[model samples]
Target: MPTLTLENDVRQFLGSITRRERRFAAAGTLITLLVLVPVVAVADPGLVPGTPAQSATEQAVDAARGDSCRDTLPADTPDYVVCRWLTPPQDAAAVAAFWGADGGANLEQAQPLPAQYVRCNRKTDLSTSTTCKGGTTFCRQLPSGWYQCTDETNGKVTYERYVNGKKQVQSTPPPSPSTTTSSTTWPTSSPTPSSPDTASTPLPTPTPPDETLPPDGNPPDAGTPTTDPTTPSASVPTVTAEPTASTTPTTPEPGNGAADGDFIATAKKARLRIWLESDLADDYLAGDTAFTAALQQLVTDAKRTDVTGVKFADNLAYTGFSTEQQVIRFLNRATQALRAALPGKRLAIGVVVPELGCGDSQPCITGLRKRAPLVTKQHVNRYLRAGDVDRVEIAGGLFGRTYRQYQVTDPKTGKPTSITPALATRAQWMSVKALEWDTLAQIGVREYGLAHTGDTSPWTMAQATAQIEARIGTAIGLGASTITLWGHKATADGQTYRLLNAGLADNPTWNGLTGQGLRGRLAVVIDPTSTERGAADIVHYAKGVSEIFILI
Candidate 1:
């Protein structure tokens, strides 16, 4: 068998072996043993020593001939020359020593180098090899024992060697470029001169004089006298001028109890329509003689003050007499008296019929029920024609409760204990619907006043006043331009006294009623009287009037 000492010769001999011929295979085996066995022992002198040299040689040949053999070349070989026989050891120290010192250190540090036997462009290599490309390189064995390669473009290094007796490859990436400036510049010349200074010099302080004049026009010396004859003398004048008294006359303040003229003025400006009522009609007509003078004074005052109208309780005409005939006669007499008393002023007849039972007087109730209606309609109609009564107010319920009651039965006991009811009928001679009758009569007679009334007894004087005002306000709000209050006194004197006193105390002119929101003008009338009155007495008396009379 021929000896195969070189690695490449062994490889070639193995390549020529036949796959099917038994003799050629035997020959190839013998040749493989002779060629690779000695090289394996030389590379690894530490192989087991007990075995026969022949057997050991055969085992080494098997290792080299089999796939287990590694084709490691010795680092001592030049990088450009191919090794024909030598096999290298796998130890890291041996591999590191094979490369140059720097390369060996890098290999020992476990850096990665390019693969052995791979070609790279020379432009990319630092080895001065023509085969390397730009930006790339190849690994080359160094004189010591290790293999290494460097990236030409980035200056990064790679290495291949054995570390701790094991082969390894290592590579390092290049560092990034620096960003700091390389140098700094400085100014070498001076700046231009500044503009000429134009700031002004400060002014010099002035010295004060040693002596100053006193504020009172006298010399600084207190004892020195100002002797100029032209100057006014310091001595008191023979006739000292007194402060000129203010010539503007101040108005005398109004008396504390004086009526508010502003309220009256405002009322007049508003041009409000008014309703008037007197609370003392019944007492006056019962022959209360003192009331007669007072009543006349009230009407006279109303007229003097220019009241728009007056109302009288014609419905209570009989309160002056005990008999029905006397009542009728007194009613006719009172009507004539009021007409004469308030000649030019408007007059209205106010009537209130009893709605409840008469106190133990069935006859009176029956007579009243029948005659009341006739009297009211007759008087209203008669007055309308005569131009005495401008309107008729039909009010009721002086003798009884205005509201009705009904019997409420207990549901469980089936017994009635309480009485309750819907609205009660008003005890007027005519129903509320009958207002058209008087209204139509007023229209026919060319009178402007109309009629409306409220429950008489259940309401107090204040309530009645408020209700009247509200009614008037409503009428105004509803666009009615005019409204009138009508009624007669219980008697002439009583009517006059009540009207004058009430008007003076509570009417807009005297009591500031208009200021308190009682808007409108009022017309009033006094009952008939046989006495005569002087102009001043009438004027003064009329001016003292306050409230009107209303039938309750």
Candidate 2:
């Protein structure tokens, strides 16, 4: 309006503002231009296009999710920088470029630098340690026996030298074979000289019946038999009886032509058994006369039906007794009652042996005890010495199912409390399992089951199936000849039993006993409540044992 001739020379005036101020103004103008983008384009000479603006949050997110390589020097490789990802060759090319390479190289082609030159600390935990700590300074192999971890934060590297999963430590040279005594051998059922050359003797061999003819069967008269006395009496007209068909055994088959009572015979032939808790048979504890009567009746009923190895188990921890003598008395009474009911049949006396339990409660004797495993071993050893225990039925309680959390009533307050009976974590469970099996195994008792009761976490059918499979597989792997399951009543959906069915169907050979009635090393215990379909599955797939014993 004042007739002022403005040159409109922005560059000439831009120098008037300080460099910092000019930059701010340029930023603001650029933002404003972007706000109204495509609507206006100022065509000014010597003006270069500006990059689009981004908010701090957006920039940060981009950076976090960006594919740019990072400074990873002093790493396992001198030429390689860490990339957000280096999977595809195309992506790895960018990673390679960060190392001043012409292009990305194959990730598979990358070789790690030597780790021997830079020793770090050994890991105290299962994880390989990377730094020296606890007076140690060497990255060693993990229990997994795969990679060696280093404590060094920088230049972390792993050297692989595969060996057995558990490290073999040589504390001292093993005593020379000549220097060793013969005491290491497991004893036979019959007593032998304590220091007999036990190392060379095999396990007791089963003796068949004498082959001589009965006195009732008049042998060829002495007058007619004049051959040499050493000639074996003309071989006594050797008889060759035809072998029984595979489907037929000394006992009747369960589903083919036998009654439910025949399940007893089936169980005996298969070495398959099912047992309910003593409470299930009768609310019995400490073996009172009533309890003894009830137990005897239960065995009598089972024997009447043909089941011979039937068992009724109770938690030894809940016996409300302290001294081992009292416990032994209880077991002895039960054994006497059973023997009175059935004279000579073997009974696998099942007992819920726990290393820890409620100090004084219905489920456990309310105080905390540390020597439960040892006590359990002692209890079994005592039972064996008592002469009625055929096999020690080790209930699954804590050792069998790791996924369970048991609830018990606090005797003093009458309140429910949750307890983790054994190791809860899967890793811990595996470790404990190995130890538990070894403990019982070392005692040389015929151990039946690392069996489970029905209590478990709510899991999908597939999950339950997999877990049962894993549990059974683990028990078998641990040298358990029989894998028993209890507590089917805990799962209402029948998923656990169904999953068990699927496992049996998947592998009949796992049973170790089939229709042939030839006893197998692997026996799977079933619940009395198993679905009809589940039972059929076991019967169909049964290899060594076609019969299943229900946990009553």
Winning model by lDDT: 2
User: What is the RMSD of candidate 2?
Assistant: 30.5
- lDDT of every predicted structure (CA atoms): 0.31, 0.32
What is the per-residue lDDT of model 2 for residues 1-552, given as tens digits with 9 covering 90 to 100? 333334445656876775435433533453343334322322211111121221110111011232121211111121222232223333333332333221111211232223322221322221122223332222443333223544344544443432222223332333444665322222243333232112343322212111111111101100111112124422221111211112111111122322234334445554444332222222244246656555644664556534545454433433334445545666677677776776765555544434322212223321112323214333434544653566554444233221123444432355654432211111222222323433433211111222122222223333222233333332343234454433222122111212222333322212222322333433444433333343443453244432244544
- Every model's Cα RMSD, please? 58.6, 30.5
Q: What is the TM-score of each candidate against the true structure?
A: 0.27, 0.34
- Show where candidate 1 strays beyond 4 Å: 1-266, 275-292, 314-320, 356-387, 396-552
Candidate 1 has a TM-score of 0.27
Error (Å) of candidate 1 at residue 369 is 5.1
lDDT digits (tens) for residues 1-552 of candidate 1: 356458778787677774323323433453455445545644322122222232101112122332111121112112232222333332322332333232223432443433343323332221122232343444566543356666556766775555454665566422222433212122353342231111122212212111111110111111111112123532211110111112121111212211122223323443433333332244355465734653564355445353555554444432222333344454455557666777766665544333221211233334333433323333333434444456554332122111112222332355642211101111121122222344443321100111111112222233223333223332222223223232211121111112223222233212322333322333322222211221121232233223322111
- Superposed by TM-score, candidate 2 places the C-alpha of residue 442 at a distance from the truth, in angstroms, of 11
